[model samples]
Structures are given as structure tokens and as C-alpha cells.
Target: MESKTTKKVTRGRPVCEIKQAEQKAKLIFSAKQLLNIKSYSQITIRDIASEASINSAMIKYYFGGKENLFVELIQSIADEQFSQFEDLGEHKKPVYLFIRRFGEILQSHPGIVHLLSEEVLNKTTPLARAFMAAFPARVSKFLPPLIQQETGISDTKKAKLAAFQLITLLVSPYILKTLRQQAWQIDDTEIQGEAWAKDLYRHFIYGLKESNTNEVES
Candidate 1:
């Protein structure tokens, strides 16, 4: 008697699905590279597609549109950085670690800093509003506790303020990169690496400690 023959079915992603994922990733990467070179208003969907060497329709199909793609790109970057802070609350030196990591991120993606600065200054675009709302909420949530731990500022509001101040100090140099180079002769190499981060951390901590001492004296 001839036995029945059975066929096994594979239970993984189909070839088309894998191809789609690769295409999407390429689009995202190309968008990021273009963002570093051009402003949001200046970059077009065709530009991203061309940069990725894919069809423009793919971007629309994958991300809905240029604006949505931009939002997704920024969201991905933010998620990556925030994920690194998962253990921040439990860190022995949260402030130092945070500063060092932040510096590294900015150095790695100076274009993101520039893009955010432009969006913030404009304050009229949907991207700007989305970023303003989302970014600060995350900062307020994770950073205040870390700031409290580091500075002994028991009040949440004060701790948040301190956190904001520290962020400002870390971000200002990057945002003012052109001005620093043109006027002050400070180049990117001098202002962006581990050495720069160390100096910023020391200066900020010293100033904060001095302020706390003055408050106690008063």
C-alpha cells in the first residue's frame, strides 16, 4: 500500500515581506543622511528615494508621506537614545553617565541636533509641535528622578529644572556650532568628543554644587 505523502510548510517571513523590510530600512537610512545635509523644507520625497536608490512610491507606501517619514525618523532616533537610559534611575552616577551618553549621541548625529533646533525655532510645523510635546514629556519623566538622586533636590519641580539646565548646557555648543567656529574658532572636533563631555560635566557639577552651597549658607 502506498503511504500518503506529507509536505512541511515553512512558518517564517515570506520573501516579499523580507524585501519590503529591507526597502523600508533603506528609505529611513537615506532620509537620515539627507536630513543631515538639507533642511526639511529643502528635502523632497524624490530626494530621499533617489538617495536610497528606491522608487519614490515606496516611501509613500512604507511611510505614508514625507512628513510621516520625518516623524518616524525622529521617533526612531529618540527611542534609541531613551532606551539607553533604561537603567539611569539605578545608576550610581546618573548625571555623569547621562551627560557622556548625550554628548556621544550629539556627536554621532549633529544633523539631528540642527534639525531639532530649526524645528524648535520655527515652532509652526506639525513636526515641531510633535517633538516639543514628546521630547519634554520623556525628559520630565526619566530625568527628574535622576536629577533628584544626583543633586539631592527632593522637589520634583526643582529637579526637573536642574535637569533642563544640564540639558541646555550640553546642547548649546552643538546648536551653536557655526557661530562657535566662525566667531570663537572652536571646531567640531574640540567641542564634541569625550574631552568636551568631561569638561561640561565638571563645569556643570561644580556650578550646581556651588549654587547648593550658597542656598544652604543663606
Candidate 2:
């Protein structure tokens, strides 16, 4: 029962598993590197493989195709981001910190906005729908409390509306950067950074206070 051949086979299984995991991680890394320089449609399986210095066929073996690979990439990014946002609950200035952190994330991953537009907002494929159901839709539930905390807007409906508006304010600059740049020569640097975040926070707070005042008067 303690034959050397049995022990050899058992030990080999772990090595095999480790190698496969490394290959899969290589593919994912290659995909992310390519995505940074090129649009999703512009990237091919070979490009990722070449960037990774791995065999091209391994892409199909590991991720099935570019679509699934990108989905996994986005999912991984979302998981990290969601965890970071959850940690904001412990921050004293969660609202402003959230806005600044959100802006930095978008700026760092310039391709992510395009991927969202192409995959989730513009299409209703099963993968796209699943992505929305899994991440953004679920994350929406977490924002209203932050809104309520910052603005003292206790009404559930009003807090939810404020949350949606705040997110749109933060995301619009990135989503519309190309058009805004062409039309007004405005750049992302002007709309991002600590100064811009502080300005946004002040404006949002002012608007909420004005609304509360008007409601009291009415």
C-alpha cells in the first residue's frame, strides 16, 4: 500500500495543479495589459498570448475566449473595488472619500468605462445581464445609506435619488470625456483630483440643504 509509484503520482498532482493555475493567471494578466492599451474589440486572443509570452491556445483552454476573459477581468476588478468601498463605512468622511476614491479608480482603469458601455449598458446578453445583476445592481443598494449619512436626508426615496445623482455626477466626466474634450477642450485633470472632489461634495451638500429648507417652508 506504500509503494513509491503511488507517492510519486500523488505528489505530481499538486505540481500539475500549480502549473495550471499559473497559466490561467498569466492569461488574465496578459488580457489586462492588452486592455489598457487597446479597446476590447481591438484586442485578440493572440495579442494577449503574445503579451503574456504564453501559447495562444492556452487562452481558449483557460478562459474560452476574449469575452469570457474580459468578464472575469471586470469581475475581479469589481470585487476589489466593492471591498474597498465597503471599507469606507469606517471612514469619518465617507461621502467625500468615496467620491475621490471612485474618481481615482475610473482614471486608473480608463478602459473599464468603455467595457461597461459595450458590455452591460449597450447589450442585454446573458453575460452582460449577469454582470449587472451581480455587481452594479447589487452595489446600488449600498449607496443610499452613505447619502443619508452625509446629507441628513432620512427619507428613503430622497436618499436613493441623491445616491443616483451623486453617482452620475462622478461618472459623467469619465463617460463623456471624449465629447467634452472635443467640444470644450476640457480635460480629465480639471475634473478629477482632491480639489474637484471637495467642490463636488460642497455642491451636493448645498443642494441637499436647499431642498430640505424648501421642504420645511412648503
TM-score, prediction 2? 0.86
- Error (Å) of candidate 1 at residue 142 is 1.4
Clashing pairs in 2: none
TM-score list, all predictions: 0.85, 0.86
Clashing pairs in 1: none
Residue-by-residue lDDT tens digits, candidate 2, 35-129: 77687778988898889888777777667877888778877777777777877777777888888888888888877776666556778876587
Listed per candidate, the RMSD to the true structure in angstroms reads 6.2, 4.4
**Model 2 residue 208 distance off true place after TM-score fit, in angstroms:** 1.7
lDDT string, candidate 1, 1-218, tens digits: 99999866433222488788888788888988988878877889999999988878877778889988888888888887778888877878888888888788888876678677887666868777666655666876887788778777666776778889988887888888789899999888887667777788788777877777787889
lDDT for model 1, please: 0.79
What's the lDDT for all of these models?
Answer: 0.79, 0.78
RMSD of 1: 6.2
